[model samples]
Structures are given as C-alpha cells and as structure tokens.
Target: MTRDRQYSFRKVTLDDLPLLAAWQSAPHVRQWWESAEPYSAADLADPKAARWIVSTAGRPFAFMQDYTVHGWEDHHFAGLPKGSRGIDQYIGDPEMTGRGHGPAFISARMNALFEAGAPVIATDPHPENALAIAVYKKLGFEPAGPPEMTQWGLILPMLARR
Candidate 1:
C-alpha cells in the first residue's frame, strides 16, 4: 500500500480500547509481546503516558507508546541518562508485517519527538527479535551496548540529525 493510503497516526483515546486489546491478542503480535498481563482501558487512560493508534482511513492498524524516562530504573535501560525517554511500538495487523511499515512509522514518531525538544529516545526489544532490531537500525538507531538478558537496548541520537 502507498504511504498515504496505508497509514496514519493519531493520539489514542478511551474509545480505542477494544481495538487495542484485539491487536494485543493477535498471535503474531503476541509472539514478541507475550507477557502475563493484558492491557486495560485504565492503562491507556494515563495522560502522562503518550499512546497513539496507527490506522488506515480510520481503522486501527497498530499501537505506539512513549513515556518519559525520568526516575525510571527499568531493566531494559537502567543506565540511560535521567531525561531520556522510552519508545515502544507494534504493528497489530499481521498483514502489515514485513511490508516496511515499522521503519516508516517509527521514523515519523522520532521526528515528532525531536521537534518537541526530546533529546534522545530509547527502545529495547528481545535480542532475538531480529526483524525489529533491523528495522530500528535502519532508522539510525544504534546498539547502545552489549545485549543484556532478554532485552537489547538501542538508542537514537536526535542531535545527530541536526
């Protein structure tokens, strides 16, 4: 699908719960996202956490999440600078996988963040998620350090783009 025809991103709202839950439950999407808990409407209700729905002509296609890293001590990025932010995303529709949407969507989001004064962003995917790792790398994210158990940290430098 052409870029204009295939995707759009909008701030997620409470009305998007059902669509988000369904996407989170898809087998292909769950493979890389298998965690014990499921997301709830309350989770997406937090104003401090930014979430977006990736859609095509108003239909949900994926989910993207971002949050400030201040005071975070999470395993994925325990060593990052205090002001850094975390970004995570998933393409919910199985058909959209392997079609290059990941890179485009992420790049779009990163550009927006940088424009909003974000200095750096980070993401950590399972080391075995080669497709995701490659897509992040192709968008100019570099391996931040040696792989840690389960999570591989990657960083994108915003100033480098200036």
Candidate 2:
C-alpha cells in the first residue's frame, strides 16, 4: 500500500469552476479525461451526487465525486445493489500523480462510505488506464464485470466490497 497522506475534501461550488477548468486543461488530465468537465448546475442540484475538490496541506490538487449507483435508470452501474456507490476522480495536478495521493485519498473516502452502510463501493476506470487500475487494485477493488460501454465511455467495472 502507498503511504497515507492527509487530504481534505471540500464540496464544489460555483466559485470553483474557474479553478476546475484550469485543472481540466492540463495535458495529463486531458489525456484520459479528454475534457475537464467536472459538474453542471444540474449535477450540483442532485442530492445523489457528491462533488469535491481534494487538497493536501491546504492546496487543492484533485477532483473526486461519488454517487448512487442506481441514480440513473440506464446507468452502467445501476445493477449494483441498492445503496451501492460509484466513484470517479482524477489528480488534476500531474505533480500529485506519482506521489500516492490517489490511493490514499480514495481509500479514505471509500472507507467512509463503507462505514456509512454502503455495501460496496464501485469504480469504473477506463480499460486501458493501467495507472488507475493499479490504484484501485491496490486499494482492494476487483473487477465486478467485464469492460463495457456506457454514456460516458468504455469502462472496466470494479468494486470494493465491505
């Protein structure tokens, strides 16, 4: 396991769009994310989703969100058990990528979800995203199903059971 680091999460707000946009523009983020689109007004209005900015030592460096797997009728993760949650995130700052924050913050967040009664925490990393897959695997996530396509794109559905 990667060494744990202290990270803080803050709910995203209208005031954060500019900073998020800048992070999305980074080539490292754009390579897989393609676009930096984090949230829309509708996304913020939805009680099912939680959007956040991840920071360390008081400086934000990543974006993360978790939502109900069954929130969308046709969503890929809808088949998961009710109350199961799905998460997606990116280390917007490339500088933070190789430093272990991904697994550390993500594991911390998933642990919280488990403690809150989540039966399983799901993740759908792109099939070719080895780095992301590694991070998930290191945190005990395993393939829940084969790779498949959805409205967002292709994904390898994975889950960490409680």
Across 41-61, the per-residue lDDT of candidate 1 in tens digits comes to 776676546888987667677
Per-residue error at 64 for model 2, in Å? Answer: 0.3
**Candidate 1, which segments miss by more than 4 Å at Cα?**
1-7, 36-38, 71-83, 149-162
- Tell me how far the alpha carbon of residue 147 in candidate 2 is from the true structure, in angstroms, after superposition: 1.1
Off by over 4 Å in 2: 1-4
At residue 35, give the lDDT of candidate 1: 48
Local error of candidate 1 at residue 133 (angstroms): 0.4
Which candidate achieves the best TM-score against the true structure?
A: 2
Q: In candidate 2, which residue pairs clash?
A: none
TM-score between model 1 and native: 0.79
TM-score of each: 0.79, 0.93
